[model samples]
Target: MRQSVGATDAPEVRPCPECGTEVTVHPWYVTWCAACDWNVDPGAPDPERGRLAQVRRRLASRHGEQLAQEIEQGAGGGRGGPDRSTVLAFGLALLVHGVTVGLCFAAAVLIIGGWHTGIQPVLGVLLLVAVAVLLPRPGRAPSGPAVLYRADAPGLFGLIDEVGAAVGTTGVHAVVVDASVNAGVRTYGYRGRRVMFLGLGLWEILAPQERVALLGHELGHFANGDVRSSFLMHGALRSLAEWHAVLRTVNHDSIVDWFLNALTFLPRWTVYGLLHLLDGLTMRASQRAEYLADTGSARAGSSGAAVALLDRGLLVDGVEAHLRRESMAAARAGGGAGGREEREAAERELWERLAARIGSVPESEYERLRRVSARRGHSVDDTHPPTHLRRRCLASGDPQPALVVCDGPRAQVVAAELAPARALLARRVIRDHAG
Candidate 1:
């Protein structure tokens, strides 16, 4: 039977597949016969291999690859990429600064160049008007039903049950929607509460343990009330940043622009400097939250499995690249109205490009690059922490600091009761749908 490395330390005597020499199988080297370096197929039906295969299957099921595919098809077709939302955030910032600089420049011209005319004041007012137009207003608070959209209803239900059991709560409801690799917890409608959105892509690439880890993290957001706080903070920052950018831009080309430009050298440096600083702070906070979620996942289930899944996730191209590409694509499509569809498409493209670039390198080389990227301060206005940092932190396993059961007692009971039924189901599903 397949045995967990964590379950034992005693070396088990087994024949090496290659040399047939009696060799001791150590817990750490579960995937290969240490003496001969013979590869072990984890999915093999032999009892020991079957155990590893089951773990792999569990990881795949939790990750929801099938669901991710379905969502991609529904959201629009092809492997969904990032689109407008990413660009809009940048675009909005640009527009705000452009207007501000222009206004300031005009004011300076009037004061310094002695062009104090009625036209100047009118121009100033117009610049202010433009600033008002460019910045986004605060969004309405989320409320209403807790809906979760997904492609695999049964699988999702099982996951929800697992999460609920882990957290000591009744199961949450979910609904599947069309989108690749995106998920979020939202509060919407008139009575604002909690709802979850599961994207098809999220399930596509993650193993089961990673899926649980992700869910645990999201659920932690809900539990900690961080979601609302993030929304408010982001809205306020965007609004203030827009206002400042407008003021800065309106001053450009005017006498004020010359003074400020002389003082600052480059207007963009001044703006971007502040923006990057704020983005970094926010990213750091988000990273910490991610760690908490990882802790929660470990509490809910297998830590090693969760870590393995997260490592895999790090390999997937991130959402930012997808967003960038999507924006360019939508711009090309001539649907530049800044609607939801356009925004989602833009975000997808941005992430897709990043993923493509990263995927081009060999796996071993890629890991090295990722480590280097993490250490050299490579974060660029990202909301999430670098994946390498996340992996390292989770692997340390010291964050939780208390003796809490990784898997819930009730969950274990439920799994024990359902294992037989699930096994039968798995057999039939595999036989009928073997591809």
Candidate 2:
């Protein structure tokens, strides 16, 4: 996954068995192709054929028994299942859009509405500008060699050791600041040494076992080399969004802005629409990774313990509903009028309204709501998956053959490893507030 390539050459593509879409053959790649929701080989030969063959053989073996029953009952009635319906709906949507655009063009000529003569070109140019701005910048790539460690924060050093040992990798290093309930592993330094960001809030809220599970997930990212690849992809998208934002801000006085404002608001809706699309894709992937992480944690520790931790976290956090509200608030704030303060007030009002709709609950319930808000949902910007699905995955038990060990020594080992980081972080909290 960390194999570096020079700028001069194009990466090779292999057809994915899952979707039959051409996917880049990279060592660290693990993604389903967008065209078809198939399990892709990043750089390996087609496994789909083999997989299908195995399935056929299994079906053949049971053909006389289960197949006859299934046929008699007409169980396998649908063609390609709901996926076909999804594809058909998508095609119809595109066709409808095309027809609508055609109709609009025809209407523009017949009616002297400003939408026909002036609005269209400005919208087109704004989109072009957005594309130009949001595109990723290319340069000398960051290497993955040197380890950069930060010990300034409390529990900073101990957290590193615990997480490093949990993942069985010495490739961990570096610390970054994040205010949100956001913490994760990443590659850093000139050589791209793995780094982990342990969020202050996350550390404060979750219990020891839950923390370990979270750390394990981060370690999984590092071990799998997902950090570097994600960095590159996310960096590109962030760069483009930033550029588009800057350009939009600068061009506020331009005719393009006016045209955009005329057409159900410019760049805002367009940007958000793109973000929602990306968020949908990301959420799906995140959900899958969450399941894998739960399995990984179960393998590393106790499945029962993992499940308990997830259940507790979900109960304490109330993460899902809270995140949904936050997302709605953010969207409202972004689209609202007035300055920052005014928009924030409006967002707050919206939150209050939403809370009111839920009706008055106990203090405990309110606290739960707060926890949910703090956890947040799968955002277009988020790297990790949602916590609810993670809990479900843990509850589902290990997906493969695994043992459930309740040994004291192993548990003690994990506790001992995590203690220093926890203590250090706790002290850091005291010092910050004390000052």
Candidate 3:
């Protein structure tokens, strides 16, 4: 975000507060010394707005600090097999699944045994409906535009496979490329084939080594045995969430509504209690799994790259803001989605442009972001430990050589492979701005 003092005015020079370095003050952008990084993030981070958000923030902070302490003391080693908490959480999850199973069984019995009774058919239908609604739905393999199967990009897949081997896992079945500024891994379909999502927003901005770090961290989830992400636990938690969602939408205008709400209150509260318990039981293990994933990133891409990978996350907001501004400016100039040629050009050039834009950010901006993280407990998102702590944890580890390296020549092939994804995302961005 840069601006001129005026069309004819020269940009002003400002002295740094922390270090008396003379710095050029670009209008509308932050004024921080490249030497000392003072007041780059001058405003307070917005407070989380609601009780649930506040609780999540506190929990993330608590877990981050505690896990960092454990790492410091060398007591955070991975334990094989399910812990007591994992066992108990799974037991509770099974009970939740069992409730829906029982409903289906009862519906079958009622429908079969009382075929002549009109009331039994209605009751059975209701039970069946409830069972259908509560049944765990298996995720399907990701498909459609921009979804890259292994055959489509062997170089990318080969790189991923090597990283997977380094982290004691196998290659992902598919790769989903999207515009989101994040990445994640998940299982899909009955076979639970794993796929990884790569957000080009994050991907384009990463250096080759950091890209390996990103892949290492996501693939590490499978090897690390993060039970919370397993189908059984995640399915149960998702089911319970649906239950809560259904229970909370009370219709407020009738005695029947009041009666139904009252009748379901106990079950609703019970489900709520179980959800909290399962979350509590898994929280520590989940946090530790995250740290293990970070370690895997370090091993796969070197500790220095792993730390830098996390540091890159701090630039997400700035990157996103720049994208929006670019989109808007292009739209106003009658170029965005206005002509086929212009749109095509953007499609081809956007990734390289984005990479260049973020790559050019000054050192002071990153420094400020690091300080802001300490003040605000910021992360890539709530699911992560604080970025600062993740960096510290990576720093504490012994430095190692990269298991998977994507050199300049190899990266060009991967870029050529991603041409389709680049076009798809560019068209979307341009069309959105056109609207």
> Any idea what lDDT model 3 has?
0.80
| Top candidate (lDDT) | 3
User: Which model is ahead, 2 or 3, in terms of lDDT?
Assistant: 3
Q: What would the per-residue lDDT of candidate 1 be over residues 1-435, giving only the tens digit for each residue?
A: 212213546667877778886765544333344344454334233322567656744543333333233322343121234234333444544544555566667656654565466676666666556545544344355332222333334545566556645644334444433233566665543444445655434443444455566566556555433421444445435755664564453456789778765665565566666565445334434434455555556555456655655665554444333433444444454344554454443343332333444333334334443444343322333445455655655565443321222245534543444343333332332222121
Model 1: per-residue Cα lDDT at residue 432: 29
Could you tell me how far off, in angstroms, the CA of residue 283 lies in candidate 3 after the best superposition? 2.8
Tens digit of per-residue lDDT, candidate 3, span 18-47:
788898765435776667656656786677
List runs of model 3 lying over 4 Å from the truth.
1-29, 32-60, 79-85, 335-344, 378-381
lDDT of each: 0.46, 0.44, 0.80
By TM-score, highest first, what's the ranking? 3, 1, 2
State the local distance difference test value for candidate 2. Answer: 0.44
Better of 2 and 3 by TM-score: 3
Our tally of clashes for model 2 stands at: 13
TM-score of decoy 2: 0.41
Look at candidate 3 and give me any clashing residue pairs. none
Q: How displaced is residue 204 in candidate 1, in Å? A: 1.5
For residues 1-435, could you state the per-residue lDDT of candidate 2 as single tens digits? Answer: 111112123446778776577865433234345465354223333323577656744443343233223322434211223233234433433443444355455544434444566776666555555445544344332332222254343243555455446555453555543323456665544466666665533443444455556666666555533321454445533543563455353345989777665654565556555444443334323433444455555554455556544544433233334434444444444444543453344333332333332322223333333234233433333444445435544554434322323245554554444444544443333223222
By TM-score, who's the top model here? 3
